[model samples]
Target: MNCEEATKLLDGYLDGELDPITSQQIEQHLRDCRT
Candidate 1:
């Protein structure tokens, strides 16, 4: 996913509302992105 989607999912992640796949996507994005 893009930064926009990962960024948007941040809240849901913190709130424990997102599914495993979505949360993993965001985690992967953060791991690979540095800007």
Candidate 2:
């Protein structure tokens, strides 16, 4: 997914609402984005 999509999903992740697959994707995105 793209950055915008990931960012949108991140909120759900923070709130513990995302499913495992989406959460994993978001975690990977966070790791890649950490500078």
The top-ranked prediction according to lDDT is: 1
**lDDT tens per residue, model 1, 1-35:** 88888888899998989999998998899999988
- The clash numbers for all candidates, in the given order, read 0, 0
RMSD of each: 0.8, 1.7
Q: Alpha-carbon error at 11 in model 2, in Å?
A: 1.3
Give the alpha carbon lDDT tens digit for every residue of 1-35 in model 2. Answer: 66899978877999999999999988888778754
Worst lDDT run of 10 residues, candidate 2, spans: 26-35
Candidate 2 local distance difference test against the native: 0.85
Q: How much does candidate 2 score in TM-score? A: 0.76
Instruction: Quantify all predictions' global Cα lDDT against the true fold.
Output: 0.90, 0.85
* CA deviation > 4 Å runs, candidate 2: none
Q: What's the true lDDT of residue 3 in model 2?
A: 87
